[model samples]
Target: MANRLLEVSDLEVAYGDVRALWGVSIHVEAGSVVAIVGANGAGKTTLLRAISGLLPVRRGTIALGGASLAGPAPEAIARMGIAHVPEGRGLFRQMTVLENLELGAFQPKARANMRQALDKAYALFPRLKERAGQKAGSLSGGEQQMLAIARATMSDPKLLILDEPSIGLSPLVVQQMFSLIETLHRQGVTILLVEQNIHQALKIADYAFVLKTGEIAMQGTGAELIADPEIQKAYMGVLEL
Candidate 1:
């Protein structure tokens, strides 16, 4: 059996009294890419936030490497080896590219190997090296996204959770972003991706889940989901009589 890197079972989350997720369960195996694809308000971000410890779980379990992640803070979750690159590509606007990357290594284990991490980060994103001194806010949309992923890797996370990595990018840039994700996977990072780009997400996913109204709607291998007529009509813009 493959090693399960991240497992979430019966996860329920809420904002005040309004529930956002209901009994959601998902697992990502080591060295595999698992995608959660859904429309807006489907609670994709809620699920990611719950796993990252940004939101309190009202029910069920979240385990990383078989250890519980119930009460830890967000930073604690990061130290536990799950790096979340949120939807907005959160980076310090006024800071230089190097500065943002350095911050990613604040964890003890990562801090110890910061230099090597920096080297690897720059190697993966040579543009970041070129703009090492440039303010993060000044970079183009695609370059900023690149820096975001590079920064997340500075922690050398066991599982990388990406929330809409392709959002707001041009079509060409979206392709490049997905290619970069593939590169990261090739380098041995297990991924749990939450995306609205169903076709692209499913194309790269080893396994996938569809979320609707904060609940699981369907699931299958990438190819299987892509070929699914229901999925095609609903998310892929295919017309069926």
Candidate 2:
């Protein structure tokens, strides 16, 4: 049987009167990479925010490892082993690369495993290790985005949620990022990827969900979704590999 690592059921999130997510439901199996793809304002970022506990869930439940995650603070959720690398690469600009990475292990246990995490992060992004002492703000856009993801991985979370990692990155760098995500998947990290880069995301994902206007529009195995004609026309453009 497949181990269900994370589950979100009938999830609803609203900003006062504006409903951003409406009954969004998805599941992540252990050690699997799941992609959530959609266009702008399609609730992709909102879904991540809700799962990370950064935004309030107006209804429904989120469970991680079979435990309820409802009403938890972002920090508390982090401690429960869900690391979120939000949209816009939210790295502390004034801080050094090392300092920014260290913040990922803010929890006591994650802090205790800091050395191991640091080594892993360095291995995943050698550029980060080379620029450890340099300020985060000094790096290029792609490097900054890489730093954000490396920092999140420093926590060694059970689930890594990334939002639009390829945004603002060059094609070459985006390829590298996707390669690293694949490597992480092989190392047993369950991922919930929110991205607009459909082709790249599907290439590395085991399963995929399409979010259209806050609800799940379609879902299937990566290969199945890639083969679907409607998905090809709407989200993936052409069916060419």
Candidate 3:
């Protein structure tokens, strides 16, 4: 597709003798939210890492805006406009919230747009603006997730990759987090999210891919999968009484 923003085709990644992802392919169109979900060890995070250039690609290709994006350094990937907010938030615990955010603008292109980006970040998460002077480590769990996402926005990325945004968050916070994702989608950010919260992820995603044993086992529109009997049983934890 001419407007496809991110594409991963037959992507394979390995660690030592163990292969984490084998021949996985995904296509994300521009201006949409795509979700990847599966049981633990399904290689969802591995795919994001490969696309962001944190891990080397053993095979296949990842393209953003029709250009190869998986061959560069992690910093170079940021410059190419793929922002990955990893599984653990990955903030500098010792640094102030503002400092951690400033670090995300490390790439030359991002640095040049830092001011406007910072403004946009703060606008999205006002709690972050209040905590700008406080250390990232000191923030509450929900606030930390907010900062992680806000920091990524500082890079002015074309694609935002979020891994497990609901991890450690309260039920109320998870709802709020999902709300923010909806807002981001409305604001024109193309998002690729991996989450254990299958119900929530599918609710907002335009498309959903179910990963199993390091490969895409199922693919469909969000509503289609949400209603599928197999998906409902496997991932939804559906209880038939």
Scored by CA lDDT, what does every candidate get? Answer: 0.93, 0.91, 0.92
**lDDT by residue (tens digit), candidate 3, 95-189:** 99999999988888789989998999999999999989999999999999999999888877899999999999999999999999999999999
Model 1: per-residue Cα lDDT at residue 161:
93
Model 3 deviation from native, Cα RMSD in Å: 1.7
The Cα error of candidate 1 at residue 32, in Å, is 0.9
**Candidate 2 global TM-score:** 0.97
Clashing pairs in 1: none
Which window of ten consecutive residues has the lowest lDDT sum in model 3? 232-241
Which ranges in model 2 have alpha carbons more than 4 Å from their true place? none
Ranking by lDDT: 1, 3, 2
lDDT of 3 at 26: 98
In candidate 3 the C-alpha lDDT for residue 66 amounts to 83
